[model samples]
Target: MPCCRLLWRPQRPNEDFRMNKQDLSEDTEVVLLLCGRFGGEKQEPHQPLSPREYSELAKWLNACNLRPSDLMTDAGRDALSSLQVARLESKRVEFLLGRGTAMALALERWARGGLWVISRGDMDYPKRLKRQLKHAAPPLLYGAGDKTLLEKGGLAIIGSRDASESALSYTRSIAARCAHEGLAVVSGGARGVDAAAMQGATEAGGYCIGVLANDLLKTSVNRQNRIGLQEGCLVLVSPFFPEAGFSAGNAMGRNRYIYTLADQALVIDSALRSGGTWEGAVENLKNGWVPLYVRTPGEGPGNVALVADGGLPFTLTADSTDSLVDLFASRPVDDVQSGSDIVETQQLLLVPEAMVTAEAVTAEIPSEPVQEKSQPLVSPEALASSPAPQPATATEVLAPSEAHASGDAVGTVEEPAMAEQPAQLLSCLSLDMYADFSAKLASLLGGGALSEEDIATQLCIEKSQAKAWLKRASEAGLVDKLKKPVRYALGRQGSLC
Candidate 1:
């Protein structure tokens, strides 16, 4: 019934024609309806496609360079008659003509907030995803968490949902190390290893996210270490509706998303011919995306085969931070080394008039007690009548530029210093040209519009460092972060007055 809704958007214009076709055969009527019917029910239930419906679909598939096998059995055609063929072509036209009915449902969620769509061409879509799509590309993606994380390279760690104790320990270690190196770890949100990796990032004070196979809301039932998610330490996502339950097919489909979400995939441990995770690895290898196989003392020969076939070794104890740092440092330095426009912009951002007004409100005004009449000889009664002066806290409303300047002077310059850095150095940074990026930063902060590429270019900092800066700014009553390539913006609260 709901699937019918998916097909109805474009068919409204032909409703009269459909209504007039009372004499149409059952097979022709079904084909004209363009509904996917199960193969088993076709003959046994006396349901069949007209020869024409069958032939036209075959032609369409051939034209698309696909076989009839490309579509699901439910979508296949049984042979159709001559008249049915003409009707089938019209039905095919209707199927292809459908409007936004299916899309509208997905879009409604996004419009209501907490939903995002990542199509194939979006720059924020992970490049790794593009690599995997070459083999088994998804139609569309709906997810949560920092979208920019997709752009900032990270390592994917995955393993059995029913992992053993030793496997989990090793998985946790690798995940924590990756987080410490400022790399986000990606995994399917099953049990065991996935949970371990997410918790590891939380413990390490780093960001991590889970890609789920089931409807995110249903599978999140036993999400034990949810402290991380609640605290914005980790991201959780699923392609299905939040209420959808688990299915074997969906679980296998999840492997693609996990691999697609990362720059490299690290298989901690897996059995031969395990679901698509292994298949996904082979697919990834074919696509030239690197696969990292961890070497365990008891790992089977299959892992060795993987290693032999161009899969790289993921040495957990190696200089992970150095490797990640180098990766980040290798990013283009032009954003920082460019021209004078940035310099002027940085200076303007330092002390805009708005910031001055906010600061003035916080600055204390000295009180001048009314000049007492010449009754200085008055006793304790006069002293008791005097009002006591209340102590005021020192307040400062420095812009990002000012914060950088002061920060540089103190030699405690960390990423995104509020008002402390050399003007020249500050000029190199890029900022969003919002009417006000700091408006609601105090209440609903942490979502920014910066992509990983945008951040890489603007901050002229390593990916991890940019994330750290965003995290700090988010914590400090500054910005708001939205899921999916987590962009930052000002919070709903006014400011840190």
Candidate 2:
């Protein structure tokens, strides 16, 4: 028997809502009072509540003697005892029955588990977000990618939606560099700079995550960024449910998420008082986030102001790539200024440092006999063109016999040359002690002898440095470093040993 056969048709609104239409303004006042009790404390009248009318609901909740715990079901007491339960239901009815009915569909998707929420007070919430947790903080967040990305350190790069071509190229280059050095990237998933950054990370074979203001499935208004999301190279996240539409307030609300998801913020381009990227970076700075400002030679006063006010300035030129790589090598675990702070954490992973060995690194000199081309004597024309040295004074000039004796006294150029050769060798030798040591070890090892410990003992260098140099030589195709007691030998397919 189908239970639906006995379904009672819902009465039309005009029939059931027959109560006197007294000043409905009074009903709104009552609703406002109820909102005040449920929401905590008084809210300024000018700052209206969210669609649910939680603004003044705190007063009504207190008047009703309701606590958050009251919402939980106990052995006997059930959800009906909860003011929150009643308010949520009533608000749902009001919205569904009124002009803003579309939001209910979004709420339905959320309730159906297609969405999950992170509240401001939730422990899983990002601590950095707490700084913006005042009235501006989003009440809840929804996400799709690794939620942990929100709590960990990452870099944020942003710029104008109408970004110039050069700006996009610069953003990609910097983002790729940052990602190659193992930093995560966070951005608003906007069309220009943000899309370029996310694309750059993907191209660099690095992970990049996107934060969106609207639903994951919906295309961003600037559809260029949408293609990246579709390609699976980027992760799209949003705070609103799948059915929610894009709105200005919703876009503004995502500003905090952009800043909170990153430890450092980079603004590639933005005007003074720029609503999107610049404002987010400004908010991040106030809350102690490190800001990286990128500027062209003449990007103008806004970038200058940011640089003057403690933002680290960087030029988006090819020459700065090495410096950029060094910047990205940093882990967010330490303060940006003191590179030493990272050493403690880094020391846990021990890899030998390469030692520059004398033999392996040296460029080979030609072994075959050298041939010399005969030099022509200075032409009479050339000699005539050259300026003659000033004639020596009578005291400066030596007698003919005296000049011959003086020439002999001046000594052989070959003698001086011979004297300088050993010193040059010694100086070259001094530059790379470890390399020289490794060559000796390689000779011993290639002869099918000598343990790494033996080489270390003979070389008078640390075991690690010895092994490192030997390994480096091997890597450079100079020698073979075998496992177990780690011995080094000249490579079988050798270079000019």
Candidate 3:
């Protein structure tokens, strides 16, 4: 088989055997070869193997006790076939041959670039991501600079690409304070808030990890960034091709890496309706990946909304780094694990379906149901027991003499029924005056699912008010309450409103 032939390749007399093995295992050369070849890099809107696919493949490899290089063997093909992953038969031989042709060039480029590649199986891969994201963690991480920096958890400073000067300044100040307390600052290495945070940490002579979405090669060698790299205080990493340009999807995908690598996350600024910053913050909140914080007296509606949603308010003047550190220390680490375990269990249950064609798997999943906002604002049971209202066309006013002559039944109505009329009347009133507030609430919910506490923080309203509005909207069929911890999402009518 192919594995036997590769094992017999002539080796140089002076070549170090340990170095050769290290190159194979630590650099993920075999997996990279497979990925470059039959993994379909030429496909439009290129993407690497999805987290689910990687997890499935990993499970198969473990079950068979085979290394990535073994995949070139006949036995490997047999093993892969047994797993019944979709499209395996059509691509097996081509994938193996492609790996053979690309392996040399890939190794050369990686060596020349001074890059280190970690696959999911590698010991040095970030355990935090695997623990938090589980099957959703990236299969490979391409990095430059010190790899050990990834293990040192720190604060993640995230915000908008167009953050205000005041927000940027606050990010810098907080990052520097984190540095003084011997903490690293993690960021996406984009412009605005990301840049400010990284610069602050490095300038303070502290470590930082820049999780870049693109331009990893260029950013690693920049004159400004080079000093920190040389000092072994900055590490730049990416899951995308080193030379690839920025992509909206990639930018969003990398946000999770930033949040996962850190113990906590701080949002400096975010737009109200939508933005990467807002989306990432909301996602982190839902996923419970880390402790989320938003700056107090925020720069925009998004920040305020996030704070209202349950994000802790972070005030630079009022809060000190030591206190922040103490707060983090006091929190139970197991709380995070508990949240991740529930999500992981849900994902694990879907692995079998995920092994089928992607399209088929997606087709099997049902969409979330939406509630209408114009519907009755009371329960069906209450509506059933209540009296029917007069028709709109019955506009003629009845005289008391006519009512008595006709033996009107109006006087027979009970006082209790009259008392219930006002509530029903109020429920029927037009909510147009609160349209702006409803729209803003919908925008926050639409960004991503949130809990009631999150809604309260995001709207800067009392918990009771937030609950009342949510209940009213829900009764009007405007939002949905998802699973445990009770996340909220915009219903169809709410999204339109």
Highest lDDT against the true fold, candidate: 3
Local accuracy of candidate 1 as per-residue lDDT tens digits, 1-497? 12334344343444343221222232222332232222233233223343334456556655555433223233432222122434454344344323225333433333233435444334555666656554244423455445565555577776544454555566666666777778887766544556656545555677775676544432233233234444555565655444344455555556667766776677655433233344555555555554444342213212323443444444443223446445434543222223243233333323332433321111111121122111111112311322431111100100011111112233321233232212211111223421122322211222324554465465455777666666755563344455554565443211111
Predicted structure 3: lDDT: 0.57
Tens digits of per-residue lDDT for model 3, 1-497: 45522532233223453221345562265555444322235662333445566567666677789876667667776776566665434255335434443445444455455566777678888898889888778777887778789988899988754554555667777877888888899988765677767766765678898887766655654555556666789887777666555566676678889999999988876654356676677778777788887665454445544554446655555245456677667665433333234233222222121232212110101111121111111113311322431111100110111001224343322112111111111111233434435656745654667789988898888898888877876664345556555766654211100
lDDT of each: 0.42, 0.43, 0.57
Q: Quote the positional error of residue 273 for candidate 3 in Å.
A: 3.4
lDDT of candidate 1 at residue 78, scale 0 to 100:
28
Task: Report model 2's TM-score to 2 decimal places.
Answer: 0.45
Q: How do all models score by TM-score?
A: 0.43, 0.45, 0.62
- State the weakest 10-residue window (summed lDDT) of model 2: 393-402
Q: Candidate 2 on 1-497: residue-level lDDT in tens?
A: 11110111122123332112211122232222222112212342222245234433333445666432232214113333343542344344232223212222332334333233445445655666666454344444554434555665578876655555555666777777877777777777655567667666655656666667644433322244333334544445565433344555555566667766676777775443334554555555555545554353213213433443345545446446475545545534233432232222122111122421222111211121121221111112312223431111100000011011122233212111111111111111213565355435533553454567777887787889877876665454444455554555444311110
Ranking by TM-score: 3, 2, 1
